[model samples]
Target: MKYLIVGLGNIGAEYADTRHNIGFNVLDALAGASNIAFTTDRYGAVAELRHKGRTLVLLKPSTYMNLSGKAVRYWLDREKIERENLLVVVDDIALPFGTLRMRTRGSAGGHNGLKSICELLGTEDYARIRFGIGGDFARGQQVDYVLGQWTEEERRLLPDRLKVFGDAILSFACVGAERTMNLFNKK
Candidate 1:
């Protein structure tokens, strides 16, 4: 079986470590833990990993955040992967920081990258792992905050939180959505 694991984040150093890059960070943790390095693939940088009998194709889209659908669709089509087997990891400003949420299908909730994938795929039926970035911005500071990095205090707790998310993603690939949700929902 094949799975397309997409990490959504903007390209360039300017976007690194921003809340928007949480997806990238989660993917990074997975790569490190498994010792699978991502080399540039057809549509993005990809790493093929086999953990616990499951094969995973980790992809960090080169299309940037807004147009992530382009890379995602390309990989999905080329690999002949089903929509259900495609799991997208993206940061969510709607959920509180350090909280991770997994869903089978839902609207983008104002997430442009997810919105683009929904539009390009013509559906939101695929799975998504939403890494919470917290929403505490005043008035119209939402953009600035999402594109910014976590505070020092938040950074201190990064490892524990990211581990849970990483394990949840692995569970999603190893088990199924229901089991993954059950395992990480309380984490």
Candidate 2:
């Protein structure tokens, strides 16, 4: 089976290590652990990983957060991967820090990246993994908070959290979204 694992984040050093870039961070960890490397590719950075007889095509969109759907659509078509086998990793401020949730389909919940994906894909039925970045900012500071670098404490805890995130991703591609959600949503 083939799966498209998209990690959404703005492409630039300014965006690196920010809370909004958790998707990229998770993909990086997964790739590193699997001894794979990403290469610059059309609309994104691309990497291939094999797990349990499944091929996972990892993507970190260069289209930036708001325009992520362009890259996603391009890769999905190029890869000829079914929408059912697609997974998007995104940051969520609704949940507490380090929390993770997997859903088969849902609204974008004010995320522009997800909104673009939903719009371009013409449906919200794809799977997504929302990684919590916490909602500790004051009102109207949402943008700054998301693009901000992690706190010292958060940095310390991130490696462990990312490992779990990577594991959940692998579970989704290997065992299917339903089973993976049941296994990781409680974490």
Candidate 3:
């Protein structure tokens, strides 16, 4: 089987290591865990991971954050991967930092990258792995909060958190969504 795992984040020096780029961080973790190298190319920086007889395509959209749809649609069409076989990893502020959530399908909930993807695909029924960035910002501070780099405390827990998220993502790709959710999806 084949899977398309797309990580949503902005491209550029400024967005690296920021809360909004946690998805990219997770994709980095996946590459490291698999001992695979992401090569620069057309769709995006991509690495093919083979696990337990399955092929997993990891992607970090090069179209930046808001225009991520183009990259996603292109990849999905080129790979002929079903919408259900695509997993989008994204950073979510509604949940606490280091928290991970896996859902079979759901709305973007105001995430620009996700919203763009939904518009391109014309559907929301795809798997998703959401890495919590924590939300406690004041009004009009949402942009700063997400685009900001991780706090000292969040950075402290970054390693273990990334491991957990990485493991959960692998499980999802190797096994099934129901099983992955059962093993993850907890406080």
Candidate 4:
């Protein structure tokens, strides 16, 4: 079995460890735990892993946030993986911090990264794991908030959150979107 895991984030030192880049951070932690490293390739950094006789293709899109779909599309086609087998990890400001929501299909909820992917894929039927970054910003500061660094308290709590995200990714591959969603989408 083959599965494609796409973590949406901008590629740069400036974006590292920021709220919008939590997707990248989760994938990085997943890669570390799997003892694999990502190599720069066409569209993004790619890592391959095998678990329970399944081959997993992990991608961290270098196309930035708004253009993430380009990398996702390229990798999916190149890997010959079906859209249903793809799982996107992204930050969500709608829920409280440390909250996780997994969905089989849905709208982007105003997320440019998800919007790009949905547009390029021509549908919103793929699976995605949304990591809540919490809406804790002043009025009209949404952009700065999403792009901003995590607070000291959040940073301290991030490792555990990333571990959960990584486990959710593995569960999605080991089981399926429905089962994984049931297993990980805790309030």
TM-score of each candidate structure, all chains considered together? 0.97, 0.99, 0.96, 0.98
Q: Tell how far residue 55 is off in model 1, in angstroms.
A: 0.9
**What ranges in model 3 sit over 4 Å off?**
none
Tally clashing residue pairs in candidate 3: 0
Per-residue lDDT over 16-132 for candidate 2, one digit per residue giving the tens place of the 0 to 100 score: 989999999999999999999999999999999999999999999999999999999999999999999999999999999999999999999999999999999999999999999
Which 10-residue span in candidate 1 carries the lowest summed lDDT? 40-49
lDDT of each: 0.89, 0.96, 0.89, 0.93
Model 2 stretches with alpha carbons more than 4 Å out: none
Best model per TM-score: 2
> Model 1, 71-131: lDDT tens per residue?
9999999888889888999998888888989999999888989999999999989999998
- Per-residue C-alpha lDDT of model 3 across residues 1-187, encoded as one tens digit per residue: 8889998898899999899999899989879987999998785898999988888889999998888889999999988988878999999999988888999989999999999999999989889989989997899999999999888888999989988988887898788888999899883
Question: Candidate 4's residue-wise lDDT over 1-187, tens digit each?
Answer: 8999998889889898789998899999999999999999999999998988889999999999999999999999999999989999999999999899999999999999999999999999999999999999999999999999999999999999999999999999999999898889974
TM-score of structure candidate 4: 0.98
Residue runs of model 1 more than 4 Å from their true location after superposition:
none
- TM-score (C-alpha, index-matched) for candidate 1: 0.97
lDDT of 1: 0.89
Error of 1 at 86 (Å): 0.9
Report the lDDT of model 3 for residue 136. Answer: 73
Once superposed on the true structure, which residue ranges of model 4 sit more than 4 Å away at CA? Answer: none
